[model samples]
Target: MSQLYASLFYQNEVTEIFSDRALVSYMIEAEVALAKAQAQVGVIPESAAIAISNIASTALDQLDFDALAVATGLAGNIAIPFVKQLTAIVKQNDEDAARYVHWGATSQDILDTACILQCRAAMTHVEALIHQCYRTALAQAEQYRSQVMIGRTWLQQGLPITLGHKLARWASAFRRDLARIDAMKARVFTAQLGGAVGSLASLQAQGTAVVQAFAAQLQLSVPSCTWHGERDRIVEVASVLAIVTGSLGKMARDWSLMMQTEIAEVFEPAAKGRGGSSTMPHKRNPVAAASVLAAANRVPVLMSSLYQSMVQEHERSLGGWHAEWLALPEIFQLCAGALERTLEVLQGMQVNAENMQRNLECTQGLIMAEAVMMALAPHLGRLQAHHVVEAACKTAVEKGVHLKEVMTELDQVKAYFSAVQISEIFKPESYLGNIQDQIDAVLQEAKGEAK
Candidate 1:
């Protein structure tokens, strides 16, 4: 059942990148690259490096995944059995060259570097999706730069704000997420190449040289030391992903709330069989938002597990390292799924300008009380203005009349302000102070980043 519905939840592009075949291929690629690096450093024969690459490149299709799974169960790590199978394949071609296949390397070196390769690949897709989402949101903000809507606080009408201002905030979030992702590349993309004890003891005095060569071969940065005991890189990647997912969740929550039948201010783009209910004919649920929220809810928990795994015993971890095998990939998958869904929501979003206008009036000018208070603050003292507006709001609510009507009848308000000024105070557009400036700032910064 999980496999059947996997495509619905996870992206096919990212799924293929982290598939079993891709993982095994990465491990083999690590082995081949290591051999070449060792050869470059004169630690292994050049013929052996060539032979390892040649055999392992073709051996992927021939390797039995079921057999590898069983061997992994017994060996405690996939690299142990994987290396044995790779060596056997190389030995079949050139027996003498097979001896140097994985010389001076440990299973952790292969596994960790392979995982880094997978992360590097997955992040490319993630970054692209983030860019798409960012651009879509920025476009929306520009398109609706002056479209006024009621800003809600604690689920009640608070004040007037433009839809563009709200979307600019989302664009800014994705922009910051992109910055975070770019900043972490140096820390997270470093190569892992330490022998059994992370000292490269097996490689002797030439360990550092071999590590440098290995990293160069894989186009990865060499870490200051082996990360067998240190899990900061892994934790950093997971933490950043969790933060991005959380931002996506906030967008989804807002969108779903706006789609409520009573509110009906905005909606997910409509399509046949997209968000339809099986029994109810009128249902148009926010399915993409729900999926993004599920990912947002689950990613932090998985990120916490990675944090827990940071505690290791001695030179290596007993169960801590093992815990990462499932958690990290699941994190990547869930994050990818969330990013894709968020992009979908942004691209196909439906905005109801008329509904937004109608909803703004539902409060009968109560949402503009602050505007009235501020306008009257100069004539009446600040405290007196607040009290007068407060009383008028109460009168308006009790009598079911517009606050503008109630305020016009107030003796204090009529004493300070003309009828023209009183009418201007109630206009939602007039009360939207500096919202265009704020939106323009966000758009300008985002465009600068693009340049």
Candidate 2:
């Protein structure tokens, strides 16, 4: 374990979700559930189910990896070696019971259901961390909704906007992700059970009953069909995870830009010996953003592989089903790490309301040009007001004076209103049009999602 890459990509909590031990544990869980399900329907002896369940609870360390590596590679799946070991272990306790260890299930059934168990565990972690981002962003938005800042478009400051509005936009993406995860839980948690091909011909009359019992034991939704070759549920989970990572990447991108020494509109939380420059002592980098962006860049490739691999050969697949074995775990690991790191970024983020104000001022009243045009619009026609403001902006810049001050010399502005209105136009507070209402609606919707 390179603690460095582990530190970077695999948070201790998330890495555990995709750990070798967890894989074996979940596969054993599926096998035991299958044994119980079969026993309930008389396909397997009750004594055999008890014996297999008892042995399946053995420690992960007791499993022989050297034998499993060669055996599973030949068998093309983990459940084959796992069931082999499980049945042998059960034989030690009850020789007759060992015959029913795996009952009528195929390798894909146990493996697929085991993978779903891992997904449920990994998603549980992802969901908690995402909720952290949503709540933190909500508070920041609500706190700063009226706090004026420079609103930039295409990397150029175009108008005055509240910090709350910017934070609310970030929060909105997480809301959709949260809803997606909730909805996907239904689609992705269904159990996969088919013997050899899509038909449970091995189990004959008892297949459906055993599958229902198996799903009940695992607390997973029962599949409508065998789904041995159908992998859309897996694809759907990966697709939603891609959206989640992409959204986190966007948040990181925004924070990274804002953390620029020149921008300094926000800062990732500062800590001792953290985000420090090894060579230059004066730097505090947005390191969390780097990890998030990297995950964002890499996850789509894995997701695309899943999409391409969805076209499996009839009933079973050649390399297509095999392709999913490693890709799905990696997708979960990378995306889970991104969620965790992003949650850290949001929780510790330093909002520089002062810097926001300073950046808004750096525009030298040009950001308020729209405000001036609109206020003058009611008095003068819209086209005339735009032309007047355009000329006034040029004069203000050329003379190195404020836009409000330069407007005093223009007769078009003087004819429209008093000096007070011109001064008000230059103030950011005068131009926040409906931002409060917009932000309020977002906050309200966020609360609704919480319910």
Candidate 3:
């Protein structure tokens, strides 16, 4: 029933997501603010609040959204026609009271409320997906915590690390992003109060109370002043969302690379009808992961425009606000979809522990050079030990012999450690110092936050 994809990508389904129903909620809050402002100043009868309340309670389906859309263009936003319709409906019942509907407010008041309301709704979806992805990442980390694999520094094998360690890093990054979202709630949920320009000069003495009451009615926090020209909050929120999605994208890209046939370290599980290439019958692709990566890459670029839109002229600039109106919703929806798909991909992931171990040994004990060097440090000086290990590693590569074997053949290496000790240096498990502890710390923090 929800046309999320259609509305976001195709720009169809006008009354869905950021639609009339959503804007009507904003209008209701704006009308309440107006009535409260008027009542506080004794400008309008308190009875008007009750009348406005009743009129505003009408459903979105009762409004003439079609004519409003056709008349104003989607760019007109639903707030203008919304106030027009609300005033018309109220005036038909009581002509005298209709004048009090929008008392001291301008279209920005209603539009800003509607934008935040849509953001709240969209964020709810995004938060759920983020949590889902966090859970999947935690599970994957726990599942493969001890599965040893070759670690690459610059696309070449550098050391040995457990698959779980790699996954736990991903989990940790997402967890940090989740904490950021929680911390941003106060900043992001604040109500906008710019009237015509960036000041509340029209409301005179009752301005602050009206703003607070309006925010209370809408379940949002009131800002100290109007934000007509202060778009930093919007930019901040957009940047965080982009950062969160970007983390997911990084994970997807890594997974895509690891899923390469030459690597085969991990694979996203295939569904019954998923990942089929058009021409290749035997092809199983990382399509979902790739999709997540692509979406993540696009979110930041879209959000950057929001940041750029912050440099508007004093009071108001259609250039800045209108740019936001075009960009923010799409960024939120795309990021939400990317996060959702990332969670789905991770939840059904296939981790190959055997392949991880196999790859860890693929370098013929060269992956254990650091461990060997560290072991020899107590006997040999640090530089001397490193040179010896480096030479052994080079000989192993050039002569096609194992590093441990080369080390055993050397009298210097044998003097430092026995053959058995040399063999122990190459065991991947010995090199996993603090990795499990790090994972535990991350998981503990996540669990504590969840509680």
Best by lDDT: 1
lDDT of 3 by residue, 1-451 (tens): 1555442222222224655566567667667766865675576798887787676677355678677777567546556777788788888777877888887788887777778877776777777777787887888888888887888888898887777888899988888888898898888888877678756778777677778777876788789888888888888778888888788788888888889887887887888867778899887898777667777867878887898898888888767888887788767766776776787778888877777778887889888888988888888988999998998888999999888889888888877678788777778898888999988987887788889
Sort all candidates by lDDT, best to worst: 1, 2, 3
Ranking by TM-score: 1, 2, 3
Number of the candidate with higher TM-score, 1 or 3: 1
Candidate 2: stretches off by over 4 Å: 449-451
Query: RMSD of candidate 1 to the true fold?
Result: 1.0
lDDT, candidate 2, 1-451, per-residue tens: 3666867775677678777778889988988898888888888888888888887777365788788888987887878887888777778878998888777778888888988999998888888888888888888889888888887899998888888898898888888889999998977998888888867888998889988999999999988888878899999998998999998898889889999998998888888887898799999999999989999999999988999999988888888888887788877878888888888877778888888888988858888888888888987889988999999899989988888888867888888768887787788877888888888988999777669
- Between the candidate structures 1 and 3, which one is better when assessed by lDDT? 1
Q: Give one clash count per candidate, in the order shown.
A: 0, 0, 0
- The lDDT for every candidate, in the order shown, is 0.90, 0.85, 0.78
If scored against the real structure, what TM-score would every candidate get? 0.98, 0.96, 0.91
lDDT string, candidate 1, 1-451, tens digits: 1788665567777788889999998998899889999999999889888888888879898788899999999999999998888888888999988899889889999999999999999989988989999999999999998999999999889999998999999999999999999999998998998889898888898999999999999999889888898999999988888898899999999999999999998898888789899899899899988988988888888888899999999888999999998888888888888888888878888889999999999989899999999999998989999999999999999999999999998899899888898998899999988899999999999878769
